[model samples]
Target: MTGFDTFLVADWSAAQGVRRAGKDAIWIALAQDGAVKPARHFSTRLDAEAWIAETIRAEIAAGRRVMAAFDFPFGYPTGVVEIICGAADPLALWDWLAARITDDARGRNNRFAVAEEINALFPGEGPFWGKHNRDAYPGIPYGGRSRTAEVSEKRACDISAKASSSVWQLAFPPTVGGQALMGMPMLSRLRRIQGCAVWPFEAWQEAQAVLTEIWPGLIEPAVRASDDLRDRAQVEGLARALSRLPLAELERMMDIDAPEEGWILGAGHGERLTDLARPNSLRPPPLRNDCFALPAGVDWTPVDTALALLRERLHPVTGTTKSGLFEAEGRILAEDVIARRANPPHPNTAVDGYGFAAASVGEGDAVLPLVQGRAAAGAPFEGPVPRGSALRVLTGADLPAGVDTVVLDEDCSVGDGRVAFRGGVKPGANTRKAGEDAGEGDRVLSAGRKLTAPDLALAAAVGHGTLPIREKLRVAVLSTGDELTEPGDVPGAGGIFDANRPMLLSTLARWGHVPVDLGRIPDDRSAVAAAFDRAGRDADVLLTSGGASAGDEDHVSALLREAGAMQEWRIALKPGRPLALGLWNDIPVFGLPGNPVAAFVCTLIFARPALTVLAGGNWAEPQGFEIPAAFEKRKKPGRREYLRARMRDGCAEVFPSEGSGRVSSLSWGEGLVEIEDGERHIRPGDPVRFIPYGSFGL
Candidate 1:
């Protein structure tokens, strides 16, 4: 649970016009609390090293655990080389070997050669050559490896795997490869031991390629000459070491001291890092029913107006309560839930068979005297059976005392006083262990989780008599237009069958709202006013389809102004336009388009989110994907457009009939292609963004 709090990154660079130059380090301290501390620069290795030591010391003193990274070597020399490993002491055996080699005898012969050559001469016997040497030597004396060496290696490997996996899993193409490449660098930097560079250069290159493929944007910008060389070396070393270490061991090591436990470093590095990066969870806002007025001469005015209208109209109503298990079939939870008791409260039998001590079962058709012990749904055995004894049992029967295994009836033959088993039986077989299904104090449901059938059953199993759930919103739906008529009813001349009402009603029900049908009202000013009056008195929200435009027949707008306070703002979107939003007698009213298709589209674009808000849920603008277009089209500037499109062969193909009135276009559509306002034209095969309806939870 403890997460990272900060990231201290050192970007080492060489000063300009400097040859054979050491690094000019750039130290960046990133606080998890959203503060970016001033960047510190060092012109020389000594300065950098001193600064790092001081910073780490200060951080440690201040109760802040800091992870300090350096763009230099940290691994012990495999040969005679002493790499830039941490401040840990070398192994005891290594120290002894070094003493021997440097002594008059060995040093005179090969001590002058490079560390690699000297190591080659002695091989396993050399201080810095092999694992055997490390095992024999004592690590840094103050922070001895005896206590933490095993744990650290394990933690490092686990962290490496998690980082790699997370990067590779990004859906965005560039992100995947970028992370893959960075994996090597991260590993190399973290796990550089004294005697071995477990992660090598080769592995780092491979990871780099993967990182480049996944996140070109990130890798490209960071791949400057000053930092590239050190980064490559570091990543390679880390990746190679990680590939070899056991993931579990690594996790254990990192878990040793966590922030929650008042320790500086924690386990599950990726999770910790994410916490450090963003401590707060991202929560969206609730949808609103506020309308935007359409300008004159605009044909798509209803869409914007309807959305604005819906925001104010959909106010939250009703109170939250906990219902009985059987009654909470379709309610969202108001709070988290923990199991009152463990499931399968006690150990019980899972099979219908004899339950006897396994030690009593003998080889080859053994027959023991049968005991008259019964275990039923509510009854359990009271006493243990004697040796060479068999008990008769049924399904759901509790295992009798002194019994460990159960031989199925089909596999056993009844005898004079015992049941003979035909096959071998194991101890504790066919037994349902207590707390296996659900542990005591286990969280069964988190807060805000919707209660489903399985959840109800789980709650019952945990002995819950009732479950708390959020209050449902009270919504009143009204369809407007003289041309609209209910389905299966004979439509008079100039009347079209109503589709928006039924569709809107179904959608409302799905969103956990108590919807009231206000029926249909003709496109008359008085009728619209009467509908609003009825909705205001009866429902928390009033929803209407059509009459949102400024046309003379669009009376909902005028009625809204006559009844209550309303403000309208035009949203730059496409498809269902001419939206009208207003409030009537303290009740919000959303006036949608009369066209069935346009009305449905607008509802999804606006109404659904607003309802979500009314239901006390966060509602944010939905996200979409940018995909290659399969068709070319041109549009007027200054308006956002949504075209129904199907993804064919990974390409978005706009439907042939691309009009707001064509409801069928949406029915067969996989997603909506979003053309930004003022982007007048798009060519086939061009990349355009699209929002899939499913992403909106629709």
Candidate 2:
């Protein structure tokens, strides 16, 4: 006899006595030699439980191990109300009430609580014969008086008791009646088996899918009725347990001998579990100190000329190498990529149909005999179908030899091993000829092009494993202020919180430069000088947000002169007019205005493109689109102005307040509309060019 392990699920419905079918259905699944068969269903709980117990006992008697899961709650919450009231046992009080309730005992004086007590002792037998009114059952203190209430309480107790007694490894709450009571015991058992309770069904399904992908063969084959519940709970428990277990023990459980190999075991699933990972910043180049103050009344270079100069100076530096596929997103290619081989290496079937020699088919009544062989994926036809012959092929199958045309299966008739095509078939009909996508050794991607997913796929198809990529530039960020405290800390009366660090980090990421935060530097010139020295030693570019202006306390400009050489200072711009550009040990340094909005604007206009140049990419300035102004605004004539403005209905609307010191204006504005050197008072409906936030390294 072949012994099999089987699980049975039984469903039951309330006994309404009108030939009612059970709402609950039980499933009996077979597990033979560690493999589970498709489950069979049963409509009755009694039948399911009986079969399960019988099978378990028989398996044990035959010296075979068997595990079963029962759908029920096992433990009862003994009624403290009755116990504390000094009533004998609650069950005794229950029985005394059961004897008094009769089917005809309804009316004003009917004692219903007594009936409820009786039903609690014997679930599934309900509709007590007692009355509806009473505070407590007669002669029983605190006993439920309503028949309905008593019966409900009794069923809860019964379900709980049944769940506690089931010795199965796992318990599933019943699908229907008494679910509330059954749920508690099942949850309790789950907590004991695995520290955490089961998640909701939807989340459980997702967790199970993830586990199956990562731990291919670890889980048993049987899809337990509660497999989703068990798998999710167990996986979470395993994660917690594994964290506590020694690395060696965890590796043993994962069936790995070394830690490196074990780490890779769950790599696929781990990637899906977390968000995208970013690479660490590369060390910056050294700087040279040769501070030279800006010449007074000097004519500043145009944006285009300045960018061209910066590009020439910075483009020679190279970036770090990364995997071609992983580096595809947000990375520009260093050189043009030519195809080493043509796409679709050979002529293949474009449709799942017949492949016939085009020359063999005549204009009228020409029938070609079908070859016995069929072509499918991975199986190409060995030889050409000779003249007057056809071969059957599926989609993606290689075209048969000497066949230049394919007649879709719908356009052909087959009989007696011969296929006849409909009229009007052309020589190259349905044929995807060679080199249709690209010729052999053709240039696929051009130099300086940003690599997208499609580009990565194309590169892989060409048999290239690694690609030459320009490295990411390192930009050092320093926030300077003696009156600033870190976020989440209590600040003194004169102190403000640090916001520039996070803001600069996000901005640098957008601009494709890796930002190395040097935290907050103090107001002292020595401390500032030390910061510049450190930045010069490691950073390709240094960005500071304060102490750029000429003031007694402002030290960044003075420190830059002391630490290295000054390049350009004091751009003729509003809000960020005090901006300073220099070099510290040969690394470029940008000292932006201390105001939050001004600092942000300065990074967008200057620092961002400078980093792009250092990263070996083009330094194209953000383009502006012309739009009408919603309101009139006044500006100085000689200086270039950037007003915080937003676009709506193709019109640029300046944010209400335009003060350089007002940080709140930044929050209200989307970007700035540059009013070049000649413009002064602009009226509503006037055409103005505005640059969007996204285009300006935001």
Candidate 3:
């Protein structure tokens, strides 16, 4: 169930500069109640270090559990840590770097000089390189790696990580060399702080405050244009992911045997992390086999995978009741509507004609006197025709007795109430036989079929005023959080419009389900629990957003722990990371993140499919089209992206920013550009998979 009491994620910077607000400095965010708290930026390394220490102490001393992640390499390749730090221990390198690498608040730092010093310890300029312009370091390679990492090794994770440049390459984009130089020093500072248990190097107990290495690429999201924003986004995303991670999964992440090459916090989690990239499970059906036990520590389930598993688990509503044929358009049929009587009840004329037995007619042209009485749609003649005579019949009228054939009145001249006909008259011509369309007691509509307009007509034709059908699904929508204000109301300082609730409500209605608006609830645990307890009695499903993170203020998450049950949270799909599924008082409940864009994306991805099944409809994969990328873009491996984009000039033009909080992007984007896993160098004309907003029924 629960892993950490207080969670923190820090986006680290290795670039040397007077940090104010950019990726070059530290950016941190707290994960609370299934969502991320607003980000905090540390302009300088010293400021970041001090804040981290204080924050950890503040939370831990208050009897809260703490787990914090820092983005950077925590250990080097085998033998490198031992040689440079005078021992093979991973923390030794941290201690060693802490004492060395003089970096200050000013942009000035001896990064190149320190690389030169570390190289001096090696036989010939090794394990690190790529010097800067003002660098004093010698024996540093300029462009690429001349040799591999220490002990000629690769991290177990390197094979799957193409976005991760080899640490041996040292500096520049994608390379960890510069980062290692700047990053190690900060981690080194952590070693000196009391009460911190460095992962892999030390055994991690839930009681001890823990510090682990994190790589953004391991759970990569779409790249953000602003450095500070990007850094914070990655950290906040990680924090939310780790909070819902299963303990068994966390154990695997902590069970790294290679102490020299400390594992990334979520490195081994890639297999499942990629699943996190899956869209959230919409009304996922309950599991069939005992195999329903889900893998632990998995936060992101791919949209496709989640759909397959969840749909397979569907325990479709089995109970049924009677509904009038006229009002059964969307209801699923629970039983067949059998024909009470044969359609038309007797042989009937197909069109207006003169009727007579074929044997009674002559082959050549002949004139016949019309019978005293005529057969009409609602009226029938009583007597059989004489051998040489004929009767006039109207469309849908029963044939007169002993009349087995009909002559076209149009082909003959009618004078003085008489019809002229040709001698050739076919038997049973222009007539519908009794029980031809539907026989007596025939099943007109089968069970498990959603009723359409034609079906209602068929039921009526079969003389059934009522039909058996399953009940309609009712959904309740709730938006939770203290920071939420009703949409259309001006948000006061630190507040946001509660967009997710109304949006979800409208979507449920659009799908032909009833949506009961529960409105917004402040970040109060009891209130959330009480609301669900009340709503579950009348609703088949409960949808919610906000206060889903693990932060102190995240009462919705807290309520889930105290009363309700939580099934899932966190996914690898872009725009929506904090998504939770659970049950409240036997009612299926879906918890979405607070960010409007993320909420919307998750709704379309997961809620749509899930709700469809619940509404007695089959689950179908979301349809998408292919287009060319209108602009240049780059992304790392290990995750899927839902880029907000519009089709412009036959190409998919994406919104420049990946921030889910920006409401304008939802309106601006026609749909999403789904980028799959692995490194991508998207040019202006590269083919991109696109799914439109309308496809989600926006």
Best by TM-score: 2
Rank candidates, TM-score, best first: 2, 3, 1
The TM-scores of all predictions, comma-separated, are 0.45, 0.54, 0.50
Q: Per-residue CA lDDT of candidate 1, range 51-106, in tens? A: 54555555545554343433322222232123212223323223333343321211
For each of the candidates, give the backbone clash count.
68, 28, 30
C-alpha RMSD by candidate, in order = 26.1, 20.2, 28.7
> What digit string (tens of lDDT, one per residue) describes model 3 on residues 290-395?
2222467565666666667667765553235455566578777766789998887888888877887677666677777777888888888887888768888888
Write one digit per residue (lDDT tens) for candidate 2, span 72-128.
Answer: 322222442243224523223323333442222111212334324534554333333
lDDT winner between 1 and 2, please give it.
2
State, as a TM-score between 0 and 1, how close model 2 is to the true structure: 0.54
Using lDDT as the measure, name the better of candidate 1 and candidate 3. Answer: 3
Where does candidate 2 stray beyond 4 Å? 1-297, 316-318, 322-324, 331-336, 357-367, 407-429, 438-440, 446-450, 620-628, 634-637, 680-687
RMSD of model 3, in Å? Answer: 28.7
Q: Is candidate 1 or candidate 2 better by TM-score?
A: 2
lDDT of each: 0.52, 0.54, 0.70
